[model samples]
Each structure stands twice: as C-alpha cells, then as structure tokens.
Target: MTDPTQDFRRHLGQHEYELLEDDWLALLEADVSPALLFETAELAARYAPGEIPKTLLRVLADWLGEKGAHRWRLEALRRLLALGEDGPDLPAR
Candidate 1:
C-alpha cells in the first residue's frame, strides 16, 4: 500500500510540505490556529503559485471572510484575477 502522506510530501516543495504538514496535523488533531492556516495559505501562494485550484479558492474565500482577514482574501482574489490575464510569471507545470 502506498503512503498517501509520504507521497504528498514528495510532490510538495520543502516549504509547501512543511506548511501542509502543519495544517494537516492541526486539522487532524483538532488544534487548528488562525495563524497556522494563514501561514499555510501564504506559503502556498508564494511557493506553489498557481497550484491552488478554483474550488480551493472558493473555500479560502469563505475561510478568509470567517477569519476576518480581508487583506489575504483580497490577495487571493488578485491572484485569481491575474490568472485570467496574460502573464509569463505563472507556473507552467
């Protein structure tokens, strides 16, 4: 049997793996913190870039509203907007 967690870790970049592990552990242990989620999302945006899908964006939008971090929400929104524009900085893989 494959180890899903390990596989996930392998596909993720170092920073992405760290942030994702922290977030997953928090969720699994029911000890989630706003800061942790925020940091995870920020790191995802930075390291993974366009790796976040639209469905996840909707979820993040809701979470951002609930967490009262409109700035982060706006940043995510801007990324979505920029994705529709012509750009070479986007991740191509």
Candidate 2:
C-alpha cells in the first residue's frame, strides 16, 4: 500500500496544492522553518502554477518579511501572481 501523504505530495497539482495550503500553514504554525516552508511552497508552485491562494501568499509574505528577507517572498509572490493573472493550464479549481 502507498503512503497516502507521499502519494498526495507526489501528485500535488495546482488545485490540489492550493487545497493543501492549509496543511502547509499548519506546519508553519507548528514552527517549521521558513526556509523549509518556502521550499515546499516552491514545489507546490512548480506543480500547480496559478493555483496557490492569496491567503497562503500573504502568510508566506508575512513570514519572509518578519525574517527581514522580504525579497524571497516578493520573488515568489511575483511568480505566483503572474501565474494567477495569466491563468494556468491546469484543470479547474
């Protein structure tokens, strides 16, 4: 049998990634490193493109800003926003 979480992680397309933002946030709330969160976000973004939600972006932005590393969040946000604006080639959310 497959590990459900691993399977979920492996097939995390944009819409699914967006849905999983809550899980990511919970991880963050549990005190996971900002760097790790950022990496996970990047992976989700690459998989799902424009599917990330604004709420998740704001959370990430706040975290990065709090660390005085706004550049990282800004860059990632820019990419996500651009993707959102242009629309992704994935299935409907």
Candidate 3:
C-alpha cells in the first residue's frame, strides 16, 4: 500500500522528504521542531503502516512531555489515541 505519510507530504517533493528524514534522525539530538515531529507522528499513525512509526510516536510523545513541551505532547497523544492508544493524560500548563 502507498504510504499515507508520504502522500501527505508529497506536495513538497523529495527534497522536503529528505529534510524531514534528517529531522526525524535528529529528533533526540537537538531541539527539533515539535510541530514538524508531531505532524510526522500524526501522519504515521493515521496511516497505520507499521509498528515502527507507532513506537516512535509513543517515544516522541513521552520525550516531548519530559522536555516540557506540553502542547506538542498533547498533539502526539491525540494522534496516538486516534490509533486506539490510551487516552491522553495531559499535564497541567
């Protein structure tokens, strides 16, 4: 099946995809854009392509929460919830 994540970002072409891949790789290394990461995770979950992305989303959500990025963490949790994950337990502001 065609990857929905790829389809979602297809309009940006391959260069953008490459850049997103780079961002994905650098997720834990630096202060990556939480919005972009959340988008990627959301797309990955909506597609339900495989386990890897789902696992990554879970990890990313926790990481964002720990990093005190509550908004992005809630977004990630929402995406995960759409995939039938446990409901979001958002932290206070």
Quick one: best lDDT, which candidate? 3
Of candidate 1, the 10-residue stretch with the lowest lDDT total is: 84-93
Summarize candidate 2's per-residue lDDT along 1-93 as a digit string, tens digits. Answer: 443334436557424554476566565566666666666666665665454544455677667667787677675567556556333422232
Estimate, for each residue in 53-89, the C-alpha lDDT of model 1 and write its tens digit: 3334445555666668777666555555554533343
Error of 3 at 68 (Å): 0.8
Model 2 scores worst on lDDT over the 10 consecutive residues at 84-93
Model 3 gets an lDDT of 0.60
Q: How does model 1 fare in lDDT?
A: 0.49
Give the clashing residue pairs of candidate 2, or none.
14-48
Candidate order (lDDT): 3, 2, 1
For this target, which candidate reaches the highest TM-score against the unseen true structure?
Answer: 3
Give the per-residue Cα lDDT of candidate 3 at 82: 64
**Model 3 lDDT tens row, 1-93:** 444345435623443433444345455555557776676666555543556455667788778889898787877776666666664363333
- List candidate 3 stretches off by more than 4 Å: 1-25, 46-48, 87-93
